[model samples]
Target: MLQSVPDDGLLPVDTAQFRTAMGRFASGITIVTARVDDIDHAMTASAFTSVSLTPPLVLVCVEKIARFHDAILRAGKWGVSVLGASAVDVSTHLARRGRPLLGQLDSYPHYRGRTGAALLSDALAWLECRTWATYDGGDHTIVVGEVVALDVARSSEPALLYHEGSYRTVQETTDER
Candidate 1:
């Protein structure tokens, strides 16, 4: 015999269903970077958002299992490089684990932000931030940072977009005419 429990909303949702539902929302791509122990670490993430305007706060979610999770926690400073449409290769390289940051940095043109985090050169935009707070986010941690510095490197370039498990670029519609 088997028993069924009431729907209390405490149980986790199916991963496939959750992913399919969430993928409908398109977002910009970013590589979150940090300098720890004089070394740079980075992760490709789409789970970033603006948290506040008055304090110029932004948030990025990182899985607790990611190697940079602890690095960010320890360093307390990070940079966000908004990838240009031409930055697909950069995003793919940084998204993988166990890669040396120095080698990648050498391969690509980059610069250090005010917070000492590495920012990819020619990015659509970049932001340097310091950790302001953290919150629980299930399997991930929500890192909120106060923006200290930022710049738009190339506003004319198309911004990279990610949706439905693939990379996309923004298109200009005729309605804008």
Candidate 2:
């Protein structure tokens, strides 16, 4: 049976506690990309999920102050590149604050998707989406998109994962617990 919080629960959640608790759920890493004019921008994000099937919707949470937040709003379209284990370096770079504004992706190989958003050529999977909706999410803004194009680039590779504030990779095991 499900239990509810105490009736006296009037206090706000502790920030550190809330963050640590949320971090326990492992999630695959992704690079959110957008293009404005001729420049490409990308940010590392893990707060992405599929929201619907009938309309093929997906949601990505971008912090209000994130560099990509405003740009994404203006671009109207975005791309999600699900990173493989080999792309941890790329993830780290994009996740850093104050990262280079120009030539950020100079070292990596990529191509433009149908929406004109840059897609990492070696990603495990890719999704190109058009913004469908937006909603308030406290310090973050929830952007919903309708999937316009998607594909799996490398299905056999292990996905890059994040848990407890660290990067990890999945491994297949023959022994079942």
Highest lDDT: give the candidate number: 2
lDDT of 2 by residue, 45-127 (tens): 99999999999999999999988899899999999999999999999999999998788888889999999999998999999
List RMSD in Å for every model shown. 3.9, 4.5
On TM-score, the candidate that comes out on top is 2
lDDT string for model 1 (26-94, tens) is 999999999998888888989999999989999999999999899899999999999989989988888
TM-score of each: 0.90, 0.92
TM-score of 1: 0.90
Over 4 Å off in model 2, which ranges? 1-9, 174-177
lDDT of 1: 0.90
